[model samples]
Target: METLRWQDHTLYLLDQTQLPLTETYLTCTRWPAVADAIRCLAVRGAPAIGVAATYGAVLGAQKIAGETTDAAAFGDRFLAVCDALEGTRPTAVNLHWALARMRDVAAAALKTDSCTAVVGRLEAEAMRIDEADREINRRMGQFGAAELAQLGRPLTILTHCNAGALATAAFGTALGVVRALHAQGLVRMVYADETRPLLQGARLTTTELAADGIPVTLITDNMAAWTMKTKGIDAVIVGADRIAANGDTANKIGTYGVALLAAAHGIPFYVAAPVSTFDRTLEDGTGIPIEERAADEVRQCGGLATALPEISVFNPAFDVTPHEYITAIVTEHGVLHHPDSQVLHEFFRKEGI
Candidate 1:
């Protein structure tokens, strides 16, 4: 099933924050509600949020058209809506990319005569973006699965965070790889890091795996290296929120530690994502924007306090894993081993991206 959909001019999100316990959806008829869902993590994941923002753009146009027929008025309010959605999340380059695409569509449509045509074009653009994301996830899954198969064993894989379908418009990126590998009888089981401060791995990843009948074990964020030693894990694969030109990857917090552990263990560490996740403008991850969230998220989880109310916390939503630690990056375009700017440029050139 698709994680989100557009129906009757409303964007329907699966309400991911209620996952594992509740199968619920949040419908947004207004663009601001879409931004709120993204900000609250009700609709999350890089690709999913990107798709959400695409729909948000469509909704913004629709709302403005309904409010008034004045072209200048519609243009002003619509641009403000784009600003709001763009500000919702920063770590994921996909969010910005998707919004920019929609903005381009709006700019072009505005040059023409009709408001109705503009709304229709925006909807079409959003649908096209969502469909492209799903296709990319599928291809990334296939390419990534084959890469895992090269290890030549039915492997026990460990992953950090929730990169399953719940984290995308449909299919997935990282878990999509796992699904593809499992289909070929090359997977033994999966280890999910509880993903502290959010519990996405435990709450969402395990839920997706279980629902799909993939064997998944839950472990705390601190248990990664120990789990690698004790569980005889064959590889570590995770999703990326953003990837720099030189292959530095930014993912959910604690992913760098997971990569470091994999490196030390002599286990291959892989990052699975579509080309849309790659930020070619940034030569390395140091320049990639890092988003710091609320201190309460670190001090408390599930509404249970883990520290004193006055305790200080540094809660970055993501961390960058340097390219040296990554064994390979699996993308829809195929695997790029030991990626760098020159290598990525060649890959993009070959793919005509």
Candidate 2:
């Protein structure tokens, strides 16, 4: 499924916040609307957010194109739009990476082209980023499937949150690997964690897998350890929001706990993500900013209150898994086994990142 679509200066996002119940799309003609979608979780996931932000930049440039003829003025306003979109979410490195690429394209185009022409360049770049993400996911799927197939049996995989086609441009990161394995008839069943605060797993992950005819069993977040212990799970794979230089990963809240469980069971805990999700500047997960969401998100489920109105809630949208707990970091380039700072550095350097 295409998470984002751009046509004639307008961007369309598959409204993820309404998934499984209502398959709706949000039309965004302006940059702020796109930013709002990202902030509101109408469009989410690291790679999908990156793709949306790029198109958001294109929309911003198109708006500037109409308001100003001067290239310098357009450049300043376009940058302000990028800044707003980047601020929508702090944890996803893909958002920052996507915006940086758009900024570079604009900076270069403004020197030799008109504001209108710069808008064209930005649009083209946005499309390229969108297409590249889908291709990257496919490659990551192949690499991860090849690595996991070594288990030498039909495998039962456990996953947290919703890292499926709905979460990316197309295919997925962790779920893409699952799809690849299933295609090879190597998958027995998929166990999905009903990610709380928002049941992305129950509402989104299972929905995606079911649509593709993949056998999936949904379980609550707390049931993960017992399930792994009794169900003979061979691997645990999840997607990342941001990966630090030391291979420490930040993903949906409760993912750290899942990693710890996978560790105790001797199951290979894998993180599947594109290279763009890596923030090489941050030496470890501590340096990665974690976005804490509204208290109501914890106090209620699906807008039905589950707690007292005045009760306090600590709701962090994501958590960091220490590098040691990760068995491997799977990427479009290759799989990094027992990833560490030095190994990651060497891997990226070899890949010319």
Evaluated with lDDT, which candidate comes out highest?
Answer: 2
Give the deviation of candidate 2 from the true structure as CA RMSD. Answer: 0.7
lDDT of 1 by residue, 144-183 (tens): 9888888889999999998889889888999999999988
Instruction: Count backbone overlaps in model 1.
Output: 0
TM-score of each: 0.98, 0.99
Model 2 agreement with the true structure over 145-252: per-residue lDDT tens digits:
999999999999999998888889999999999999999999999999999989999989999999999999999999999999999999999999999999999999
Given candidate 1, what's the lDDT at residue 50?
97
- Residue-pair clashes per candidate, as listed? 0, 0
Compare the candidates by TM-score and give the number of the best one: 2
Off by over 4 Å in 2: none
lDDT at residue 66 of model 2 (Cα atoms): 94
